[model samples]
Target: NLRALFGYMWAHPGKKLLFMGGEFGQRREWAHESSLEWHALGMDQRHEGVSRWVADLNRVLREQPALHQKDFVNDGFRWVQRGDWEQSVVSFLRLGNEAAPPILVICNFTPVPRLNYRIGVPRGGYWRELLNSDAPMYGGSGLGNYGGCEATPMPYEDFSHSLSITVPPLAALFFKPE
Candidate 1:
């Protein structure tokens, strides 16, 4: 659920915030009176995996232009699909400056997996999977797009190019042109 939320937030402008220890799946509520339970990571592999994912996302946000550049500008974001509330799914694009290509983010908050989910793109190329919350390492069911997929000229969601992607159950998938 956190990954899905993060994906949704990444598509929008302004800042994205994560409280301390929340990124690594801190089970207990935080208290200002004490330090975090650092031992949880040692005790559970799941916790470690969550930490790794958080680190990866942080790196992506810093390194990817689409995620950071023009974040405060409304032009930095665009919705690919937003009427699928019934399916608990939403898709959007995070765009950088005009010189850079956009990054597409799709989120499936439902527990049902969606196959052949076609979403619009701003360009045609290899849509590399920058982040798959359903990867095995993230304590997910290992469902993913197998690294990347090629975009087709077929228009979808109001865009000239689109790509068919597999959206894992209760997961978020981030893609970038490569």
Candidate 2:
């Protein structure tokens, strides 16, 4: 699913650029002699949805300085929640431009929707959901926070504020402070 794909891209460091035919879940092996199976996109809605999601991700990475700046620097990233290997969830922040707010990325690798998922945040403010892999628009189950979440003044994961959010099954969520 696009969830895992986007998760790996946003979680890891460095510029994100995939190989040809990779965005739409290319099934066949890589071949230098043949063209990509572009026709397969029309074969099912999932492929088209994945293509759209990837485009959106690229647009976001380009538009949001918090997601792009300081790519190789460790200061640009911070962990908000982790050590939940049984549930396979990890939450982190990506700080780009210094003046701007950081981006929060939460991933649910397991196939279990975690409702009311509390995660630590940098501050107690409104955070917008920039992208949700579980949204129906991306051919998912549409299980996710409506749009954004507000962090309460509760200590969480070493942060003074925390947000009880919704992490859909096998999905990756992106949130930006606003």
Tens digits of lDDT, candidate 2, 22-103: 7887789779999998998989878877888888888888788878788889888887765778889877788876687788
Compared with the true structure, the alpha-carbon lDDT of candidate 2 equals: 0.83
| lDDT of the candidates, in the order given | 0.84, 0.83
Model 2 misplacement above 4 A? none
Residue pairs in steric clash, candidate 1? none
**Residue 149 CA error for candidate 1 (Å)?**
0.3
Error of 2 at 143 (Å): 0.7
Give me the displacement of residue 9 in model 2, in angstroms: 1.3
**Alpha-carbon deviation at 67 in model 1, angstroms:** 0.7
The candidate 1 region of ten consecutive residues with least summed lDDT is 3-12
